[model samples]
Target: MNMHIKVTTDDKDRALLAAIQDGLPLCERPFAEIGKVTNMSEEQVIARIEHMRQQGIISRFGLVLQHRPLGYRANAMVVWNVPDQEVDEAAKIITAHDFVTLCYCRARRAPVWQFNLYCMIHGQQRSIVEQQIETIKSAGLAPYPSKTLFSLRRFKQTGARFSTTPENERRLG
Candidate 1:
């Protein structure tokens, strides 16, 4: 999709993106702290973030949960081979399930790979996650082909960085 998120020339925009690259502060008002650095009000920080999200510049913005620390062990990614016409409905159904943590509608690869809709199911045990998948499969998913991918190990987990290097003007890193 050709999304046009106006590239602000103001250094404050760069500063704001850079400051929040690591994370938003865990406090009463994190944006206020960001405002202090960017010389923007808390409202301004929130507005800019919302604008970015609206423009699809940032796919998602939120806290990064450390599932293991919170006693969540089974991290399974379930992908469903839903027809493009029905993928949206399938995503809605998948996300409605309490056990489904994250849901996305991605592009479908041809003949070799067909599944597009995906959701993550997290649980304390593999069996629990599997059970949840079974429940999800019954919810308008009996017709669709699906599979669960269990993560053997997390290779990397990092936040997206918006680079403002001179060479790149419109692209985000």
Candidate 2:
């Protein structure tokens, strides 16, 4: 059986991680640029990131492209009332799909919201998102009713800043 491993790092490692959390730069030699500021060579930086990933300090790295800027703006949270035993299987199928960016299972409250499996899908138009939902339903998932909730306004979006020390005690290096 597989087991989890915990990562313990110093303040320097925390700072290095913080520098990378914003997403990698788009320019060529991005690691070199980052290395200059972090006092690490490009190869060292790359190797550290790889080590962190291997040790489970970081789940994964990704780029967050602005879909709206790319002209693919329509987005919605699609939820389904998946069977308890099949929730994991259904989530795998949903997340494995190219149209899905986010997929997970959440607690369900019947009558109000029976949806247990949720996925976020984005497309160029609302019709396309709806069509994807139709395909998902037609894939023999009609037994579990689904609902589409489109985002109206993005009020606030934030991420956690992990630190080796408590917030009040941390000082700039």
Candidate 3:
């Protein structure tokens, strides 16, 4: 069966979305800071976010890390060629490590690109990240063929954009 859900947003909801579309404030009470801007209580901000999530208006909330500024200069995307039957187990093992920041599966194009699972490791130095990868390989994943592609440059990373109207821009400004 195929089903599609449409999310409707009002002005108040737009205001809330505008406030958070960039990124939440970095502080003890981020929602309270947002509440101050939107003229809503902290409880109200929490309730609206929850309601929006339930209604499918907000799919997810994520964190974007500025790794380089925090001394994590060595970041590598490790790709693994795991068999189809063992992809899940391989992913679980990779994600269990503390240094493994991200892990997910992707489709492989045969005869060209064969990697099916990918994970990221971030560290202050290249040797540390390499050691972490070695640790991961020691943890029952040594049999899989893998490649580590170190990041050469950092890119601008931000959250999803929801509002572009002038009024929303003014509110954000």
Which candidate leads in lDDT? Answer: 3
Estimate the TM-score of every prediction: 0.73, 0.72, 0.69
lDDT at position 168, candidate 1: 55
Candidate 3's C-alpha runs over 4 A off are: 1-15, 25-43, 51-64, 163-173
Over 25-86, each residue of candidate 2 has an lDDT whose tens digit, in order, gives: 78999889778877989998888888888787777677646667687778899988888999
Q: Could you tell me the TM-score of candidate 2?
A: 0.72
> Per-residue error at 55 for model 2, in Å?
4.5
Give the Cα error of residue 148 in candidate 2, in Å.
0.5
Output the lDDT of residue 17, model 2: 75
> How many angstroms is residue 147 displaced in model 3 relative to the true structure, after the best TM-score fit?
0.9
Provide the global lDDT of candidate 3 against the true structure.
0.85
TM-score order of candidates, best first?
1, 2, 3
Stretches of model 1 off by over 4 angstroms after superposition: 1-11, 24-63, 170-173
* Pick by lDDT: 2 or 3, better one: 3
Q: Best-fitting candidate, measured by TM-score?
A: 1
Q: Candidate 1 — number of clashing residue pairs?
A: 0
In angstroms, how far off is 87's CA in candidate 1? 1.6
Task: Spell out the clash pairs found in candidate 3.
Answer: none
RMSD list, candidates in order:
4.2, 4.3, 6.0
